[model samples]
Target: MANLFQKIRKGLQLYQQIDMEALEKLAAKVDLNAVVQNVSKLDDTQLQGVMKLLSGSGGHKKKVPPPVDGDFYDLAELLTPEQRALQLKVRAFLETEVQPIVNEYWLRAEFPYELIPKLAALNICGVTYQGYGCPGLPNIMEGVLAMEMARIDASIATFFGVQSGLAMGSIYMLGSEEQKQQWLPAMQQMTCIGAFGLTEPEVGSGAAGGLTTTAKRTPEGWVLNGQKKWIGNATFADVIIIWARDVDDNNVKGFLVKKDNPGFQAIKMEDKMALRIVQNGLITLTNCQVAETDRLAKANSFKDTAEVLRMTRAGVAWEAVGCARGAYENALAYTTQRKQFGKPIAAFQLIQNHLVEMLSNLTAMQTMVFRLSQLQDEGRLTDEHASLAKVFCTLRTRDIVSRAREVMGGNGILLQYNVARFVADAEAIYSYEGTKEINSLIVGRAITGFSAFV
Candidate 1:
């Protein structure tokens, strides 16, 4: 009996590597002892029969399972048919084109310039605006578009947000008729990309009061002299809307500074751990001269800048929802396939609790943004309303993405899973439009009738 066992073990070892644990499981399903005894003394034909009994394949290859997805909550159904169609269109574009190449570009900290013309074909730029060859979609549609772009790649969404929401919005809301006519069409097509330079080197959350970028009237035009930091798309934009304090009136003014102006220079900000695909620029305006015609006529003070932010802040809240959704979906799918203790980890009660919590937060954010958009369409929205949504959604997104990383265990940090990118991007969203402290104060001031922001 011992000799028979030794012979059988040698034969199995010669054929292929055997995992003892897996072989033990297989051993339970068949009389391996008897089969080994029979095969040890058998000729080639008998051994072949014994092997055939163990092999499950009957002239068919094992089929691979289809990909698992994280959208288990069916949130996409909340979108209207038209909105859903647009969402899918952008999703397809991003999954096919952006997803495949995004990690490589992000690793190098470079923008995918080739996508500009491809994205221009989508005609989604300036989606919420009128004329200028834009689509004139509704405010809800704008939020959907932002969410769609962010679902695949937040850096691309940020680039789009700055161009369509902040830069073009400044012109649409505050520029002279001639200024709008000259810039909007070209910008809509991306023939001339635009950048919004509002945050200075020293002023971020307190930009409205602490901005040191100054503009002085000169015989030639306006001479802009200051430094702007964290200016997205500034490196390559054809025109940049620079917010500067007018020396005469101490009021913030917007100037459309052309890229080629001799005194204006933009250096790419490098070594960023978040949003690596975004090309943030550190801009220096040393007496950068601009034509008076380039001045935004209606943007008289910092109040005008706040108007642009209020419009985009709601979209940022929707973007937070997208980021959370992306992270939750990726983490949920991971737990399903990753096995532990002889079953999917997703089956564990703790994992289900985390997933349910993420979904609840996600649902709340979605519903809030939907109402916020309705208010915007009705022209009944207030700054506090938008601020509240932004604060809640972004705060919840930070929690969702962090939990997503935790649920994936070791693999969560990998870039290919897609959640890691969202995790990093969420940090930017948390503080960008306004910090939580600043946004909370906006809401507090409205509710308590006392300003809390110092």
Candidate 2:
């Protein structure tokens, strides 16, 4: 009788283990007593296997996928702890402060003026320059920061590039000691914004010798007369680094053209499809007189101007990487979450292929820019090196952004999805700094020892 009681208790425990709903369906098909008799005849191993099948413990748990990240090779691991921290800090600031409002500003074709003080507080304006309130970090940091900013919004990246690289760089590389002391600190603090006036209305690719803006030396000062087109940040910049041809020597020189100059007028260029948030201006410098002392002290020729372009072009390559990264990441996330036929589109073979292609290009661009920055830091960077990176990265960025847009179908074109902005912005990046053909000729000239420019 005791043994019978123990068996009853064991049977009750096993009954509790069975799913009542599944048991009810089975009971409707088969006799409950017969099913129990068969289950009771099983050996311990067979009984445990039956229990395993019934419990739905197919031996292991489903594996969770790692988080989506564009840095496939873990490039961030290359930075020092402090450098990595700074990179994250800047990234956090951009994601929090800039990402939320970027689409609105880009749609309105306006700059967010309020971000200036906040961006300044980060103290990252003059990223690579030493002294004068600059961070004096390595060139890689500048490139990384550029990537981080562009990752969120290319317009903001371009704005910072104009202020830090083009304008401040012109002064730092060619300005007099007094000029650096006067402008560097203020610009670094974001109190005085700056603009770079290089590409004129008619002379972009041929700016080397075709600058129509003429500056004549006068007893009172220098008179700058001509027009500059596509001048970023020109609408409200405190100072404009106007590169003009010397009327007498026919050599290009740079000057500190103040915004308040009566002869200087900047009207915002309207209806830009790409990089609309950047306040590009049609600057008319009628008799824009700049003090002789305000002239870039060391800008003797166009070669000096090329120097600044060479340095900033590397940053542009990194910007391309950032743009590609943003698009690719957004697309990847979208594909995984957007369902079709009861499964993620990302699981589809064609979608996976597209993703692999994007990752392949993105990884290549990132590695290329990483080496490019290393060359800059080592002081071995040349125009060809920068142009090659700019060409390859921008071209691949165009491809990446295109593929990114393609994967999302109709939703890709929507600004709210974010891929559309990159698609438009990639066109601007591809053309600016230097066109693909121009950069190719630069590399062509370096490789073949011949001039391809007409």
Candidate 3:
């Protein structure tokens, strides 16, 4: 026992003589992997003591990256303080009022009739117009509003687009002074709803060249005949801007047909795969009589109708950004909580790759649309500019939403996850506002001076 005590005393003295500073310098030169392996074998108590000692040491610790926002470029910062605040108000409304009811109404393929007044309270309809109860805001604000609405529910966004962009834009841009004074004020206040009737069962992308719906001048007024399909808000709108070929001039003209017209019938289309909350209709107009006073005075041909389309197509691109942003945000939140193998799946490399790719694409879309809106505000926007944005944004949206669904597995397919609806909605956005192929062709024709559609 005495010999053992002497040996322990010698070991303690030797330990006190060793300098940790000198050893640390030497440790850099040596393969400390052996030391790490030995230290890893230590029991919990020893490791805890070691960690306590090392906690105050000088090595810098690695930091985990922050969670990414779908607006990776922070484009909202470009807005004025007032506009940004308004943007938040709209976002809050969507998150609170719209988000809760969207999945329910979507499941039933019904519109929330109660929301019309609540939405009107925002006073954003006719957002870009100058007078007649409109907000007279900039084009960027209009695009931002569309994005906010779509982030929660694309159907509500579509409903608003038809009312604000397609219907009201046509009147604002092409209606007679009397026509504007008559419908613009009430419609801007949301007391009157409006829809656009341009697409037909036979003509979708060729709306400019091949409208089968016909209108004839009879001294009493004009008679409109033919069928209109996929008309948003048609079943309930107070006024519908129907574009039809004039039998005399062989030119397309616009007429504001009232809902109660005996010859005009709007039947709600059912069993739709997407945007179910939007009340799309198939309208059969058999000698639908529109008074001469209701005809848009400035609309002479399809070229006039294309003016309205040019303005609204850019808004659709912004809507695609919102859809992609919604899906990305939901999937990101899900990944942070969803665990696999006793760790967050987000910690895995592959999951992070998917997330990064989504954010990159989303940021690109947002920035592109931001510039697109800027060009519109500058009056530099053209058909090719808007079409290019629509084509790229909607196509990328499909990819983003699909990845969002993949990340959530089965929950991604369910509407409650917030991603499934976007997935379906993306499909519709892709085809609408001109399909990707058609829009691509439009851009192709612009840049190359070649018409590929033939």
Error of 2 at 309 (Å): 0.6
Off by over 4 Å in 3: 1-68
| Residue 36 of model 3, lDDT score | 60
Off by over 4 Å in 2: 1-63
Task: Rate residue 316 of model 1 by lDDT.
Answer: 93
Clashing pairs in 3: none
Query: Please, what is the TM-score per model?
Result: 0.85, 0.90, 0.88
How many steric overlaps does candidate 3 have? 0
- lDDT tens digits, residues 74-188, model 2? 9989899999999999999999999999999999999999999999999999999999999999999999999999999999999999999999999999999999999999999
Model number with the top lDDT: 2
lDDT of 1: 0.87
lDDT of 2: 0.93
| lDDT head-to-head 2 vs 3, winner | 2
Q: 272, model 3: CA deviation in Å?
A: 0.6
Residue 316 accuracy (lDDT) in model 3: 99
Q: Write the per-residue lDDT of candidate 1 for residues 1-454, one digit (tens) a residue.
A: 4654565578678654656677777788999879656667887666555556557543344444346443445656767798789888988998899989998898889999999999999888999899988899888888888877777778898999999999999999999989999999998998889999998888999988888999999888899999999999999999999999999999999999999987999999998888889999999999888989989999989999999999999999988887887888778778888889977888799998998888788878888888898899889889999999999999999999999998898788888787788888999989889999999999999999998778
